[model samples]
Target chain A: MPTSDDKPTPNTDEPVTGAEADKAAEIAAAKAKAAEEVPPKNPWEEKPVAPTHSDAMDDDDVVALEGLVVSADLFTGAVTATVDAEKILDVCRFLKEERGYAFLVDLTAIDWPEREEGRFDLIYWLHRHEDSKRVRLRAILGEDQTIESVESIWGAANWMEREVYDLFGVIFENHPGLERILTWEGFNGHPLRKDFPVEGIDTGAAIYPDVYPPGGGPIVPEEGEGA
Target chain B: MMNGPERPLFDVEEMEISFGPQHPATHGVLRLQMKLDGERIVEAKPIIGYLHRGTEKLFETMTFPACIPHTDRLDYVNAAHNNQGFCITMEKLLGISIPPRAAYLRMILAELQRLASHLVWLATHAVDIGAITPFFYTFRERDEILDLFEEYCGARLTLNTMKIGGLPFELPQGWLDRCAKFVDAFPAHIDEYETLLTTNRIWKRRTIGVGVISPEDAINMGLTGPPLRGSGVEWDIRKVFPYDRYDEVEFDVPIGTNCDTYDRYLVRIEEMRQSIRILRQCLEKLPEGPIMAKAPKVLRSPEGMVYGSVESPKGELGYFIVATEKGTTPYRCRVRPPSFVNLQALPQMVKGSLVADMMAVIGTLDIVLGEIDR
Candidate 1:
């Protein structure tokens, strides 16, 4: 029958009614309780804490290769050692022979075109069967520098070295067959380099060459012109 | 002269042949350049990369979360493992631990995907070895698993169902019951497959003593999954690394002694049974909790690199991510595709065997070209 606005307005000059004052106090108390009950911000809502690289100098494995390893650090509980590009072959041999890291889990390269030290970071992940231990070796190489291949150490490095060469254009000297792998024999450029185009360049191997010109297929009209 | 020797009729010479970039027996665009002494393979060189789409380069351009779908396309048949591998690596880089329920749910989906992948392998491997009936039988069961996947995530083949810290969506109502039912009935189907091929004289004669790789050579070739286990090496990423609550579940790592095509086949069939054991455990112990972890809206990974792997159906599928400080996109994301690495051993396996046995070797490897050429 009545609306909320029909309630009388409290005045500073007039003494407030007891029931109304109690009700007002109760409302204030409920609001305070609600404010207090608000949960802490979830991890997603807060600024995430960035992980820091920790020194792995004290690790036994890193210490085992004291002279060969330039520096060692731990990332996500895995030991990563930076070795000279020239000594990658030696390091791999030592790890495989002496350290019992018989398995070459993976070999890949990361391109850093703008870095002052080198243009690429070559990574080799090795694993040991006993105790299931793993280690990652990082080798820095200049754009024109060639790193010795570890294919002789671990037979598994054959295609992996080729893949690194195919993708990043890193030369693996003495690699049995270092020709392009993922790409054809005469692919113009290494597609994995940061400078390469994401949309892809014209490889001149277009489908239906007679019907559509090289780099041409099913042309679409301009944004507003298309239906 | 004709009675003296048949050798004088013709001069013996080796033949060089290009096997396939299109042939079905090679399985998805793999070409093997072979130097053969008559019908025996003297040397077989695997030439891959027909399906390479520069997926790693694409990962560099996309944000951390955006790369999950791209991983699905790597091993298209085993997309769930690919997604899990990428998500686990990203979580490691981001230092975000997912909720328990999410972990169990991931295990369930991953095991189901494993079963589906093995079924595909068995069907194709059987067909490749000249038994056509297993193809129909295996695919029949595989479709049910795919239907379960479709019910859960709406995509059967390339399921981009996982998220960085957890899952994209919680299970639909009655999804677990359906999955449980499938897991329960899957062993009998496996038995049916074994009855058809395990002891069949043709299958045994074709597979046994064919493509035999010694344990040392298998490890030297960096083989994983059944191929490595087929060589009698008891190694599994789930048991070794224990990602995604694999530590909580109990399952056996099936190994084979002979290291031939038949042993690998037995290893995979036993693996499907072990996957059932894992699925049963997960379905029962799926705890009630959040499906997603407490993560930032815009995921930013710390500077450095991390390699995280999962036991995909083919082998040890890994994602190696190198992130810049607080970078949303990976500086470099290299996928250690199991098929790509395992396919490297094809030449080793096919060598010194008959030309027809090459089919059995390729089949035993269980390599998917999408992952191999990615």
Candidate 2:
């Protein structure tokens, strides 16, 4: 928590002269080496191994878990994983407790719509509070598919799972409440599925009505017309 | 006997009321189905996505450059933050390093954007809690920020200033002076906001100790931004990951222990102060160099993936992009919006509180449903 009180002079006030540049370069080299040696782990408790920082990483976050190509790297003191999910929760919990990446940032699916096996990828971004590291876990599940559920670690995953299920049609097995989140009952398609049409506009999110009044009320209700 | 017999036929003392989709407090077209017992809320359920445009699906059809502006609409209040996140992702995928000046200019724009965004938050939050005059005061400062935006970028609201690599142009002349003045004086204005709300009795009664979340729960639920920091988790991607020149800028990451609505409000106010600090550091240290990255105008990345992010006012705003061998649209583009993740903790935040406090909890969460629904 570096405050103005702590820092008397502004950091940018001094010039980055040749000596300072040399110092920075030297620091960068040493720090980059240290970053590779051991990644940052849980901070509160003592650990046998020293945790390294993922600062100078180049293609380091990606992890190859059992027939899947995914990367798990630390971002902003949080572990953010990039996954091509052939496997989901198995890989996620491994990072969760074993690696201390306890928090589940979010569970989402991105639709490619163009590629074949890579048409849809399920993404899970996890965070560890103790170490304050983030790792992303992903499963490359195509459209019309289901992936593993991680309601075991974070109870908050239930609603997120429901939203993903409702929006992307990527089912999560064993979720306590894996029901539609935003969409109404008997709604046709996974509205967020890439190929799904943005049609049947529920203008004003109006509810469907029964009479000749149509499903909702009039499209525009006006007492009189004026330009 | 008559008094006993005079009891109403039906016990209709309580009623279930749904607010929003039309109400004033919702901000957007959000509906809250609340079960109330005599003006006290018993249960509340947020029926969301009244404004869903399926932007994620739409991104699949559009090219990378075109998607940046659409992001502006996601969390409309923090449009530049959204634009910055996308531009960073695009730049990373192509493996292009932007000029030093562009990064500095970005810091200035982003900090000002933060001020404007917080101004809106202050205005709206106060209005929600019955402070009438603060909105006008905050808006006056907010207009200055918008004027700064108009001076730099042609558009004020949805500023599509960022190009694929760096920026379409450089900062207009005298921009730095104006920004420096703003950063220097912004702290006093923030102090003014605090004077109006922070210690005010009604503000505290309504916010402090209301909708409290513990640090453990906040981390477990994946809450980020001020909400997570309010619970004492010192995690901010700008400081942690250090994308662009965020490493060059020096600032503090503010945290709170109480983890309540008031803690969040305090954390946000402190964060604005810190943003001003970073802006000053960036402006003084800004270098003279090209603004754009030296890459092909019509850019294409080698087939792979890149996830780029910035520490937005809300939280970690990240873009997950997968580029294919074919040099065209991205194979996949996923925006991990902070507001979306922050909203996940809402049900947890409001479970034990009175129904009206649910709005306070949600308001404190500071979610823009567009990002939540996007």
Candidate 3:
């Protein structure tokens, strides 16, 4: 699907006339013909381009990494590539080794409980010192899918992957020490999951237990645990 | 009754110790699970999240504007950059361009916050290594910066002064004069700090060549700010990816040669000087115009993703925001906190070093547990 970064479609506020539609089509065809004949100009010769928010991958880079990507979109100047969950390791390796994206800026996931494609979208942001540009890679995973770890590619991914596991409950295949970094051991639920309660879950660790009731009360905990 | 080979008095094995979720020198609520072999650190694993309040998860439930206050809580010491990163991401998502005046004002506040943050780092780092007088001198200058923040925004520490489109308010009357005054005298105070710790024998012994990280290793480990710069990487986001009016300002990105704790200290001190340079230029070229853009009060961003980062005091503070179609709140907001990523190198840096040097390494990393845990 064309995302927000694509050129917006024509406005339909007014009823279209057949003559006007024909004219618009003719103008578009002429413009396309003119573009085909003209040679591309050197971007370096033009005024220095201002920095933009869109981090979308170039069309050539997407085509070069074809089989690995499931889908790709650009929005608000940021490019996002969606790859298969199982291929994440190889894809990240390619980006790191061959592409010189040495710095793993961040590794995070977004939980979408309602999405049919998958329950979570794991995102990786990488940067290169040479070019000073960032590329965001994403992979959609099913509710039970286990992702291949990128810790081997970038050591920085070690703690980041653990944090993702702790908050989103998405398992990683080869993380060194796959444990909670934010919440402690024996925490009841994955806090960042959409299903988790906003007010908080009944973890049975509430303070001032006598003042509130159980199941999200001001003070109460589970019946047996509190006293 | 010793043996022929001189029998040991005690059993020789790696001893384990927990270094704070309580100790003062650990900075905040950071706990390090450390293994020691006769005062030499076998390994150190930094266990964070003692200050975690689920800030990223909280961003999903709050509106775009409401999220600014929450960002302030992430890196509490250098809160303006947090606000700036979030606001920049939101502005990118919403396709709003801030006015020139607002951008310049943001640079001023961010630079001032940098000075204040480095002061805190210097004060604490010095105290950790046995120097205490510098703490008083640094905090004195830091207080004046906080006063400027209070005059610009009502609050000092959690200055939620930035909005998505631009700053929430313009500079208060006479605020620029006071800020200029603060920036002018700040360098002299930094010199005072350098005099105390830069040449002192004890300070040199505690910091020089301690926690050395090679430049190549620093890049691969994803270090930024002074830690990465201290390793001679010379990668500052302001120069590489200038945000706000940083592109217009004249300043140098100070880097170190030795890649040691002393180098990091020198880098931070020079950074304070550079911030003063930037602040002076900004104050001189202060523009006149609207402080905010003409944006809709109820922001509904189109479906897309944008990552915005700034050269925050700690490192590159970035916000990766994913917005759904017509979404009021961000779909997923990921904060790439510099401290969290930089602190990953602690184990690598502290290995084979003396147990006492661990405190010096931790202080040199200049971590704020709030940012690490968030």
Candidate 4:
């Protein structure tokens, strides 16, 4: 993260021109004066304070679930628990039944094709409506690895898991009828993969406009007697 | 041939029928591979993705601010809510607070959008249920709402009216008065719709006790918005999460008791009234300040993830944004569309219901395939 400490300052060695130098000196003086002035208590500018309530998980603390949660961190307004891939089912059950995070808000995958930790991060967002709290659980999976499906816990995860399978090629073990949900069956590549081209690929069956004759279909080759 | 020996009377076979890749009542290109035992549905497997434009992928390639317009296309009918969800998530990621005026403006637009979306839902849902006249009446008010949207933003359906920090444009001159006028008279139109279908015998027969989802099943299925509320969940993100000044507004979260299609209908009607109440409050309390926050010229969020949701007309419209450290574009932007989640309950809902009642259930669900297929 690029904090204010890491921000680049103006080059001090460069000789400044007359008007520009004057403006720079004036800006420095204004900044010095502004620094001396006490900042107002602007409500909009208030930073997010960690909730004082007991139920809310502290961002900085690890849950200490020895085998299940490897590490937990709070960032960007939600607590994300990095769980052991094989133990995701156990962690989800714990959250749903014990912790009361019943509703599965969303299940999605983030593809990190170059990351050494894993190829993909399967994200599950669970919402506990009673406390209006949402917690995100992330399970790191290597290429071609499979994770247990949570359809038994949350029926809503059925389509969502299928979507992740369709778009990211992540397999969900025990997912009933895990066919493509967002893409047609027999579609070639996982489009959401980081390596997938934004312009899209030309499936050889249908000649894409950018591929064959512009503004038209595939060009059929002349019949050949001998090759 | 006619006497083909008792065509085996009482010998029942499950018939598999493919419904709607193009059928009118299926909403969009939602195709259901339904297995039927006589006229009763045994299984219904919805085949989606006809409208998938690789929106999440599209979001990846575009800059943060540029992704707002694409969000508009996900839930095209509820475009403002879509915009709101994306904008709110982006704002959370950037840690910027929008001005009070901007927040109120967003609420006004969002509530109006709720009205517009529900009207569209009512119009098409009624048309699907064979109530044709309500479609015309609902569209009249819907068109007025669209006109209001057009005056505020430049477009009606795909209103990219919201920005990441605040809003893209201020409310047009006299737009609020027109909106107030429309809000003032909107209940009478709801009354007209009610007079036509709320008590109609055919409407009741088509909707009541059909596609029923129990409250427990609804929560387990992760149903949100009206379907969950209709099942008596009493959960509304607007009230629960309270984004963009919703906590300051006064409106009831109408929930249904019977958990039937009729109750869902009643819930939606009551919801439109509640939207009006919210809209009236926003209009009265519209604040005065800069509409845009002091956001950076280019938006770049610190590494991590955030999930922000709004209670759209259909359900919880959420955006799960994952921004990498020092990145202008989101590493991943997942749209938690309500229709997609709500559609999961279809097989369960229609299992024992008649095939014809399928349309009624689809109507009651009020799904927009754009969101589902996204």
Winning model by lDDT: 1
Task: Please write out the lDDT profile of model 4 over residues B172-285, one tens digit for every residue.
Answer: 788888988999999999999999999999999998899999998999999999999999999998888888998998999999998999999999999999989999999999
Cα lDDT tens digits for candidate 2, B1-374: 36555766667676778788786667677787777675566666677777777777677668778888898988888888898899877766665567777888887788889888878887887788778788998999998898888898888888887876667877778987888888788889888888999889999999988778898888777777888899888988887778768998788998988888898898999998888888888988988867776666465555655677888878878887767664667766777778777776776677657766776776787778788777
Cα lDDT of all candidates, in order? 0.90, 0.74, 0.87, 0.86
iRMSD of all candidate structures: 2.4, 12.0, 7.2, 3.5
What's the C-alpha lDDT at position A204 in model 2? 41
Write out the backbone clash pairs for model 4. none
Q: Evaluated against the true chain A, what TM-score does chain A of model 1 have?
A: 0.74
Ranking by lDDT: 1, 3, 4, 2
Number of the candidate with higher lDDT, 3 or 4: 3
TM-score for all models, in order of appearance: 0.91, 0.79, 0.87, 0.87
Better of 3 and 4 by DockQ: 4
Q: What share of the true interface contacts does candidate 3 keep?
A: 0.48
RMSD of model 4 against the true structure: 9.5
Better of 1 and 2 by TM-score: 1
Ranking by DockQ: 1, 4, 3, 2
TM-score-superior candidate, 1 or 3: 1
Evaluated at residue B7, the lDDT of candidate 1 is: 62
Model 2: per-residue Cα lDDT over A74-177, one tens digit each:
43233445554545666766666666767776667777677776667676766655645556665677666667788877766877888878887777888876
